[model samples]
Target chain A: MEFSTIIQILDSAVRLSTPLLLACLAGLYSERSGIFDIGLEGKMLAGAFAAGAMSAYAGMPVTEGGLGMTWGMAWMGVLAAVAVSIVLAMIHGFASITLRGNQLISGVAINFFAAGSTVLIGQHWFRSGGQTPPLSGAQRFGPINLPFADAVKDVPFLGPIYEGLISGHNILVYIAIATVPLTSWLLFRTRFGLRLRAVGENPGAVDTAGISVVRQRYAAVLIAGILCGLAGAYLSLGTSAAGFVKDMSAGKGFIALAALIFAKWRPRAALGACLLFGLLEAIGNRYQSIDLGAFVVPVQFMQALPYILTVVILAGFIGKAIPPAAGGEPYVKER
Target chain B: MNKGLPKWADVVLIPLLSLLLAFLVSGLVVMFIGKDPIQAVQVMVSGALGKFGIGYTLYYTTNFIFTGLAVAIAFHARMFNIGGEGQAGIGGVGVAAVLLSVAWPHWTIAIVAASLGAMAFGAAWAAIPAYLQAKRGSHIVITTIMFNWIGSALIVYLLVGPMQAPGMVPETVGFSAGAAIPTLHDIFPAFDKHAPANVSLFLALIAAFAVWVLVWKTRLGYEIRAFGHSEKAAVYAGISPLKIIMVVMLISGGLAGMMAVNTVQGEAERLILDTVQGAGFVGIAVALMGRSHPVGVVLAAFLFGILYQGGGELSFEMGIPREMIVVIQALVIMFVGSLENMVRIPVERLFVRFDKGAA
Candidate 1:
């Protein structure tokens, strides 16, 4: 492959991987804390719809339910997405913790609720055929080229890779990148992280130590919601896309969950896995029909690669994935 | 968990209360959206239970029963098989391949052959995940979900490439009329003449009976129950976990795959992508609410059938978003499946007090 061509592919990889990375990290937190969130897709969808609808509304005239397009309005959209996701997270926490509900069932319910409510409200408010109107100007996230990117375009290998592959993205991409290290430190090096890991592996032990297992698990789930909220926002608003489409989160949340397991719930590994999955997606999009000596490969096969890969990996073709020992079981206090 | 409660209360009262809670909350949601809740409920009820609506409700119920039974069987083995969607999709391909390959003179023979094809294909789709979980310890839930997406994509590719009728649309040609299953209208002249409700509804009932017998009366069922209750104890008792997992998932996948017989041969009479839709996921809720029993599965499936048809009517009549129906369904599942304890504990306490007073 040509150097510039490779750089372009990497650029798309970075852009596409942003959502997966965010969601993957989100799943990591929830799963590591012993609450598997199958509803990541739902939460992300809710976030996308909220951010997209709110920002679009904010950009419109006040008479039309908008706050007049401003940077703050977009930020408000982000905040709304996070808030909505947190509410959903709380619902999951309440059911699986306080009520001792089935975690998987609660997660599935959250997904269904989010998917349904977002479209219902979106249709009622926008009347735009199950989508939010496209945002413009300050309401949508625009790309940002690095300070000296343009000047280095004429330089050789290093310059082309840096400029083409790493220079420009919407601001959310930078935030997602920064989160990798921040999440790593928070998960592996902090007091909270130690307690959270302990809670997942042995909530009974954590309980005996006087830390509330319920609170720790809830905190982890809420943190997941925050990251997933950003993921949903970046998908509809921060990316080159300008509007929210119903069911647009597609299966990315599930794929993110797969990536989390693939990384064995490690934050740093999740980043790598997301980027690799993103690269595969970019390749699939770029080369729909590949001819190697014989008949061409079909487009659907490429599109299905990530899911197929996840299943294959989980089927133990790679390495065995071991979940937290105490995962999926409700903690009960003894009398 | 069963302390101070009768079997009937555990079976009936809890589900009823959960259902009531779901409707009340759904009503509030409708009011919040500025729609008249009473009118919405009235429209939904009339639409679902009245003349033409009853036909579609039964039609959807037929599909739900198969998938619900599929989930129920897996639940008995303590396995989470969420790939019913994918299994049914593959099963559609099986039904189509069989119907198109043969020009059976009668619908009776064709239906039987299509069912066998569906079961085989569905079981094939589920086997890999079952084996992985049984042997390699991979989580069946994640693997099955991933397979759903893969199955959909595979079907899309097949329909667009090799299976496409000479048209540009990504669907196969319709099945020959001779192979079309007889509808309810044919069997009962008094029934709605054009309702898609077919003999498959009868088959669903039969399948439920079969499941009840298998889970209750059969030795294999005893093994499955024992394994589900405690794998370590089951192993000690000579009930191999591997055997139970594989056998149960095969049965589950086959049941789920059988849904395609209704959609492919009985209704649309063609192989189309997305024929399964979200029925597979709905099966999970149905199984949960039904407490993983056949009779409960049928009852729960019928209720969802009503919700789907009625919800459709509400959206059409009141301009409520169609998505609200799904929200309502989700709420029902949440209350009945996840938050059952909220109502159960209170009910158990009440029942205990009444018993004491009577004594």
Candidate 2:
């Protein structure tokens, strides 16, 4: 393939990788703090719907210098999306923590509710079974063309690699990249990070050290909700910002969860894992455009790739990766 | 907190509260759409219980009972089995393979072969996760979930490949008359007009009783419950976790497979793309709402069946979306989390009172 083509592919990869990265990081926080969060998909769906509705109403472009009003509405949408997703997360926490219920069941319920409610509400508002109205460019994520990268656009392979491949994606892609080192620092190099890790690995030990296990897990899971919200917004606003489609999250949230587990809950490793899966997704998308006759891989098979990989990895093909000791155990205050 | 109600009051209270809470949430959604909430609820009730509705609802409820009991059996063994959907799907394939491959003179023989095929396939399907958990110490929750996706892919593959019946739209060939469940016409003349409520309900009820007996009256059941109660203590007491895990998963997968047979042989008579639907995941809610008991799952499944049957009717009549039933079902599971509390508080109180009275 030509350098430009490769660059284009890489650019698409980065764009595709962001939502998964954000959601994976979000899950990293929650699962690392001993909270199982299968509801990341639900939270992301809620955020995507919220962001789409907000962008639709906010980007009306009134002639009376309405920048303030527009920005305010957009911010309100973001806040609302985050707030709703967090409340759902707290419900999950309350069930698992307060009621000592099964974590997986609670997460499944959250996901089921989110999927159904978001679609039902979206259809009601948008008058479409699945999709929302397309946002204007002003209402959407715009790309940034870096000065240095632009200057070197004509420099053969290097130009394509640095400028065309990685330079011009939307703001959210950059945020996803920034999250990696930031999450790493938060998980490994900070006090709160230590406690979070402690809670996952051994909540009783953390509780004995005077930290509240339930509180820490709640914080971790809420962080997961916020990040998943960003992921959802990116789907409807940045990556595929065309509209809010029912079930449009399309197992991506589950894929993100898989990436987190495959990475063994480390942020940087999660990025690498997500990119690998993203490559598979990108390949599948590309393959659909090709006419390969009967030899063509089915879309359903391609969709199942990440999940198949997850099982293979979980089945000990990978080296012994372990979860925190208290990953699914509810912390009960027994004093 | 104790206001001196009967010891069993809390057990009954949680489901009642959840029903009330779910209605409130659903009521807001109804009002949001400018519909009459009370009228909508009334329609739901009548649609589920009306003469035209009860038979179909009961038919669907049989599958729910099988799947719910499938899930509950595993829950008793402390294994989180989420592969019911996939297992059921695979089991449908097994039924198709059996029915299409044979020419049977006796209905009983065909049904028995189909059931055996389904049980074998389902057990083997679940064995993957069980093997992973047993050999590699992998978590069953994570592996079983991945297996669901694998199972889905496998079904899709079969539908498009060897199992695909020629000249049909994404569906397998219909089973032979012998392979199909016999209608209850001769046995119950009064129920001759009932559409699809066939002999499968008897099978389902028998399965439920079998589950109850195996879980409560057997030594193996005692071991399974013991392991669920405390893995460390069970292991210390010489129970093999690996053996129990495999056994539990096999039984769970087999039950799910039987549920598929009921759907394909008793209802559809062919495997379609929408086969099994989300009944497996719904089974988790049923198991939870039923508190992992056979009788509880029966009641819970019936409730779900009513909701599904009513929601289907409401969607056709009032133009209200059938997806609303999903919202209600999810809320039920979310609230069902408090079942442990509902169970614990009353049991503890009863025991304390009994001790005090003796003293």
Fnat scores for every prediction: 0.84, 0.56
Per-candidate clashes, comma-separated: 2, 1
Model 1, stretches more than 4 Å misplaced? none
- Candidate 1, number of clashes: 2
Alpha-carbon lDDT, every model = 0.88, 0.79
Candidate with the greatest TM-score versus the true structure = 1
lDDT of 1 by residue, B214-326 (tens): 99999999999999899999999999888999999999999999999999999889898799978898899899888999999999999889988898898789999878878
Q: In candidate 1, which residue pairs clash?
A: A57-A66, A58-A67
- Residue-wise C-alpha lDDT for candidate 2, range B152-190, written one tens digit per residue: 877877777767789857788777777767765445655
Best by DockQ: 1
State residue A252's C-alpha deviation in candidate 1, in Å.
0.8
